[model samples]
Target chain A: MKNALQTVLALLGEDYDSILQAWLETQKAEGVRRPDLFSDRESRRQLGDILRGLGEGISRSDLSEGIALDADSWTDLRATLDEVTQERVERGVSPSEMATFILAMKQPVFARLRERLAADPTRLIEEITQFSRVVDALAMHTNEHFIEARDQVIERQRAEMMELSTPVVQLWDRVLTIPLIGTLDSMRAQEVMENLLNAIVEHSAEVVIVDITGVRVVDTQVAQHLLRTAAAVRLMGAEAIISGISPKIAQTMVELGVDVGEVTTRPTIRAALAHAFRRVGFSIEKVENARG
Target chain B: MADTASVYLVEHVLLVAIPDNITDTEIMSLQEELSTRIVSDGARGVVIDIAALEIVDTFVGRVLAQLSSMARLLAAETFVVGMRPAVAMTLVELGMDLHGSRTALTLSHALRALRSEGLA
Candidate 1:
């Protein structure tokens, strides 16, 4: 078994350029390679690094010891795998293609071992089985790493959207306006309320106009969230005026029996702003054109 | 702890400054003292200066709300002033807004609001 692995490692160390070329061809034949997404220079450098790392890693591992990616010898291999996975995830590479990239190397390595040890069938089988196990573990590792990188990207985007979704703008000395858009889940609702309350305190706002014209739907859960936000605004000693209650939403609320209690709802944002101006003691009058 | 929340007469309004390290017993005693002074001192309003309080949990929020109503029953208005932004957010999140309890940005604002309402 040792002799068989020694021959395979020797072939890996001496002729990786040919093996890597063969690996790329196999992946292309399987229709997993994306030449459009990857420049030739980048593809060669990335695959070349992995081939080097794997050769160094397998040289220190015992063939019968099973897969130990945590082993000191596999450090280079693990690091290379991590880099490739992160790059692929950022480039929008399909996960199946990532896993297949590692798996395709098996065909090239097996062919190299066959040509060197085909005179002895038992040795060829030993090398083939040992090399297969190593490739399978590496493939599985690549799949998991890709998933982790993708999860991180999703988590960051969600955080960014949360920040962008809730913005409290101070429209007047003691008045703030929040124009809400999109769906209002419970978590997002909580975020909105927290941001509004903090802004009220920051600006010492006495009245706040929560405009929901951009909201597409007003389900029962959404109504509850809006009500809770209104209650929170009042609790902060600021008056809440819900504006832009579309006719459809009004009907839905009435049908759902969702009572807004003391929350003042207006027909449009203009009306709500007018009410806010009134609460803050701002009277607007249209002057006749003096030029006329 | 018992004397952490101090109530004193400022003009016709009773000004109460609650400390951050005030204990539950201190709050109960303070409430008793405040109620007594509202009648005895003939104050038209009570100004709770909670700027000294760093954290206002549900207990403090509910207490302020109850105190407001109790003061109203005794012919006096209660105003909580100088509430920190974080404390206000926590009160709202806890679903306790100290409803019926008026709030002001500063001690002077609470006093002015209280006095204006007294005249009205």
Candidate 2:
């Protein structure tokens, strides 16, 4: 019998128990003696027949009328069951399991009720009570499963986002140079911001050079991300030197009406480095010698 | 609303052939649907065929990241397929991280990679 109960519970998903519990409460409110339904085999059999009929497409209205269960009360019970089942389905529980659970609860309750039919043929109170207990258990289990599934999804999403945002390298005492090797989409922009800020603070970077020589093109959105990164660096009291302004990117910037005049740009990383050195009051004599 | 396209399953891996112009809403819906299927059936991995995509924006990148995490949660792996050179260049220029996230040059290659990793 316990195995049967477990089987039924597994099949019903989660809300079946809750629906049964609510029906029992409704029966009790109407002065029905519910406990005797489980003790009697005839009453149990009758309950089973009714549940089988319900499963076979007998409406809850018809079941209530046939069993002397209040029509209005049964309607409320059906609504609650529907609500619970929908909730379970939305949470990714299979519908077949839910149906099986409902059928399982009906079996024991109806079997007990069938036994009681000989003593008091109209007594459905005990059957309703038993159904109520089983349904409550099912509902609790279903709700727990739903919550577990939801949490698993949320946790996975959080972890994945974290992985995506994971910094490629940590900043030490040296002025780390991160070459912007590809397109500057918003997602990568946010990542660059976080990484650069952390590196600056950790290493107390005197100058951070972002070389975009490898970038093939620049759009307005990408430009905005760069500006935002520069602003973020300034807030951290560090200098951001953007180098490798390809002629194509420059043309796009102008065409897109983006004014990056305030952003210090250089033809290459070497030029940006020279500018950085000059800012620190040190002239690169090698470049001067080459020019000489 | 477009019809929910059928997912192609092969050797425990689910392949979703997404159109080039995938919207954010579509990505979100796909994420939800794929997550449900993966959990219910316990798939080995998922490969998103992006061969048709000419350009990828930030939203798409975020969605891929989300999908990767969702697949991991289901004990499945995720891979992007058919990354065009031009699109790849754009992603790099835009500062998108393509490294460490599983990627393949073709759908068949992605599947093979997953199989090699014992995920498919």
Candidate 3:
């Protein structure tokens, strides 16, 4: 009797078209194959590539191991799955949807194997077990790749958001401002300090206003982060003004007995700017309309 | 080898630029040189620029702190200027205090700050 792996490979070679047709039918029936996001022609081409790739490597792939996708013989198959995974992830396809392409093949392959090995009940069961193992491992590999691709995108977006949130804008010739949003964690506070110091050096800024208007929480850790940034700014010879303290955050700070040290804190950005202007030897006056 | 990179006198302010690869012996001699110059030239202010220095270890930090206090005894104020962000973070991490030493963004800013304090 041919071994289960060989039997499955034989069925893959002889009944390729039938198996492909059955797999696509089950996918369509189960709503796994999204026609709206992927064209029917492209879907067939992708499925054909994966099926051919499997046939090419399934012989060398050890059915006993849980993961055959990592085998050297299955490099081409892995590449095909990776391409499919990337495309689907970009298309906003869910993990289940990405895995279904590999999973739906189980029904077609199992059905064909059962038909061929019907006279030998024990061999038919063995082939079914071996085939399920291969398909399950492939499904997991596809899901892992999909999640990794999505994670990469998430990591990139997070970095961009961080850099975007900590902008140090020059408010005056010798004054700079950084309007901070979100929580002032250690990492973010460090970034803010770096940016503030760089701006002070770049603009020879004598004073910096850190507006925390968008930040809601004022725990001790955040207060410490703010103080550290202020100290760093001072170390660069520029003063730091912690601005935009709401009544609630003020109450929290007072209750927590958070000492902001010698660094200045203002109630609002306008007030901070005024204080900064005074420190930098500048003044702002509202001009009356000439029409008067 | 050359003590420090350069030293310039602007009015009562002494502008000293420190190189990245300064040796420990050179730093000690440089501090001595600065102390004598403060007394002999009647220099009322000192600006130590470390923009060229990439690393500021605890030893360097302690010496800077001491240098400022030493200058103060001689009736001269010290300001460390042009400290890179990395060095500042490292100093803050090490919890090094400059005592009465002030910091400035540049040599020019340090001079201005000292002048405001009536150095000139």
Candidate 4:
């Protein structure tokens, strides 16, 4: 009976029911025998051969049974079986045994079937699971790549802006001269104010000379920013001196009604320094050093 | 608008020549362009030529002060030139600080001022 069952299983391709029944019968025959052989790779391999011998019809039946497994149960079973197969592989199991172990692992077997069908792909239930996994992995990889690239670009921009904003030299003991060249917007204005305030605190400057001969025109918002900056400087116990006023900017200021009365204006940094020096009780005079 | 206007670059002075009837947009654009140029070229100072200005209002005065501060950040000096008597008086009447911030009477005076102050 055991031989017959083995022959039938080999011919039928180890359909789950046949394999389960044969193992049960073998246990009955052996009286106090353990059922551990059912899970053994060699035993599974022999059973697989028996089922395969049962021809194409038996193989179809096995396939149908696999499809009949509940989706959730099938997933759990596949995960457990794959873990076991991985453990076996790590233990250096023989290739043949590994193959049988992998075959018993539903995930790998399903993956192979999916690959075969994907070449001529269909919307079958099994194919859906495989496709979803591939999509999920691709999405995760893409999101990670995008975030990394975005962060790198932001870091680079921040560094560049900082370099552009750094002040290089101080012109006087109580007066610090900063040359501004570029369009002044709200963000840049804020940066300028912050930098100036910090410098004023650091140097204890009484006057801040701002030369803007490079500026072509002044808008209302920009005018407001400057007023705010001047106010901020005053609050910090320092004076803000504005040096450059283009005719175009002057006209705009008049039209816009922006007032800058509290701040001092100079035509150039030289004048601004002179004014600052005089304000601090120092005058520029020609120095003559004679040692001839 | 005139394609070209007289430009006088006094030694050590920034001369910004503007077109007649300078509009708000033009003023804003000029400020942005000049600021960028100052920072890029590391200009020491500038003198703005406002000889063509017929009206000096509050907004325009405010803008002038703003531009001066911006130029200062770039290590360049700013000077307002060609302030007409009427405009100056109007500015003063409006309580505007045209003289309080960086401003000049003429392009040459601005240059001389820059030179004298050692910021030329």
- Flag regions of model 3 displaced more than 4 Å: A1-22, A59-69, A108-130, A147-161, A172-174, A202-204, A278-292, B1-7, B115-118
Q: Which stretches of candidate 1 lie over 4 Å from their true place?
A: A1-3, A25-31, A35-37, A65-72, A114-122, A216-221, A281-292, B1-3, B8-12, B35-42, B54-62, B73-75, B84-96, B108-120
Q: What is the C-alpha lDDT of each candidate?
A: 0.84, 0.60, 0.85, 0.57
- Return the candidate ranking by DockQ, descending: 3, 1, 4, 2
Per-residue alpha-carbon lDDT of candidate 3 for residues B14-78, written as tens digits (9 for 90 to 100): 87898899988888888888888898889998899988989989889988998899999999889
TM-scores of chain A across the candidates, in order, are 0.84, 0.40, 0.78, 0.46
Worst 10 residues of 4 chain A by lDDT: A1-10
Q: Comparing 1 and 3 by lDDT, which wins?
A: 3
Chain A TM-score for candidate 3 is 0.78
Q: Model 4, B8-106: lDDT tens per residue? A: 334434558765587776787778777766755556787777667778677777777788888787778777766554454455446565433465435
DockQ of 4: 0.02
The pairs that clash in candidate 3 are: none
TM-score of each: 0.82, 0.32, 0.82, 0.36
lDDT of 3 by residue, A1-292 (tens): 3344787889889998888889999899878899988998888888999999988877765656554567798999999999988888888888888788779999988888888988988988877887788788889999999999999989998999999999999988888899999888888988888888777777888889999999968899999888878877888888889999998899999899999878899999999999988887888878888566
Model 1 Cα lDDT, one tens digit per residue, A26-74: 9889877778878777788888999899888888877676778878989
At residue A170, give the lDDT of candidate 2.
24
Report the C-alpha lDDT of model 1 over B1-120, residue by residue, as the tens digit.
445777888878888888888877778788888889989999888889888777877777778888899899988888887777667667766888677887776777777677667621
| Count of backbone collisions within predicted model 1 | 0
Q: lDDT score, residue A87, model 1?
A: 86
List runs of model 4 lying over 4 Å from the truth.
Answer: A1-147, A166-169, A285-292, B1-120
- The most accurate candidate by DockQ is 3
